[model samples]
Target: MKVAVDTEKCCGAGTCVMLAPDVFDQGEDDGIVVLLEEHPGEELHTTVREAANVCPAGAISLS
Candidate 1:
């Protein structure tokens, strides 16, 4: 799966990072959502989806 984030839409709630630290993180300076893995393996598919679902700002997207 491919993961992407819209930093402009991110509120830095950290929900994505908490759900899947391997694929997401926060920008050190702005606390914005950072996409760590654009394309992750099947092992992280579930977590990535959950992160997208839980993102309050709707910044996470999977395709």
Candidate 2:
């Protein structure tokens, strides 16, 4: 699956990073969601989806 994050909409909640650190991270200054890996493996799909679901700002997306 392909993962994407809208940094502009992120609120520095860090939920995505907390749920899937391997594929998501927080910016050093703003703590906004950062995409660490765009195309993650199948094993990580669940975690990535969960991250998107829990994101308070709805910044995470999967395609």
Candidate 3:
């Protein structure tokens, strides 16, 4: 699975980070969504999808 995040659209809710720490993170300075893995493993697809779905700002995208 491939993941992407739009920092400009992020609201810093940290839902993505909570759901998929291996694939997402939050910048300490601005609290923006950080894409830790652009291409996560199959094992992480489900959680990644959940993170994307729950992103309040719609900053997360998957392909």
Candidate 4:
């Protein structure tokens, strides 16, 4: 699976980081969503999807 995060659309919510730390993170300075892995392994797919779904800003995209 592929993951993408729109920094401009992020609201500094850490939900994504909580749900999928292996695939997502928060910027230290502004707390925006940061993409840790553009392509995560299969074992991480479920959490990644959950993070994307629960993102308050709808900044997470999957392909």
Candidate 5:
């Protein structure tokens, strides 16, 4: 799966990073969602999807 984060819509909630640290991170300055790994393995799909679901700003996308 591929993941994308819309920085403009991100609220720096860090949900993605918290849920899937291997696949997502936060900018030190802005705390926005940062895509750490684009095509994560299948094992990580669930966490990534959960992150997308919990994102308050709807900043994360999975494809």
Candidate 6:
């Protein structure tokens, strides 16, 4: 699975980071979304999807 985050669309909600810290993080200064892993292991796919689902800004994308 592949994970991608559009920082420009991020609203600093932190939902993605809370759901999948292993694959996602937030910028300390702006609180924007950060992609920690562009391609996380399959084991993390579910959580990553959930994170994407819960993202209010629709900044997380999986392919």
TM-score of each: 0.95, 0.94, 0.96, 0.96, 0.94, 0.96
**Count of clashing pairs, candidate 2:** 0
Clashing pairs in 1: none
Error of 2 at 52 (Å): 0.5
Cα lDDT listed for each candidate? 0.90, 0.87, 0.90, 0.90, 0.88, 0.91
Clashes by residue pair, model 5: none
Q: For model 5, how does the per-residue alpha-carbon lDDT over 1-63 read when each residue is reduced to its tens digit?
A: 888889999999887888899998888998887888999999998888998999999988877
**What are the per-residue Cα lDDT tens digits for candidate 3 across 15-49?**
99889999888999999988889999999998899
- The most accurate candidate by lDDT is 6
For 34-54, candidate 2 gives per-residue lDDT tens digits of: 788999989999988998898
Angstrom error at residue 51, model 3: 0.3
Give the true-structure RMSD of model 2: 0.7
Count of clashing pairs, candidate 5: 0
TM-score attained by model 4: 0.96
lDDT of 3: 0.90
Candidate 3 deviant stretches above 4 angstroms: none
Per-residue lDDT of model 6, residues 1-61, tens digit only: 8877888899999998898899988899999998989999989999999999999999988
User: Which structure is stronger by lDDT: 2 or 6?
Assistant: 6
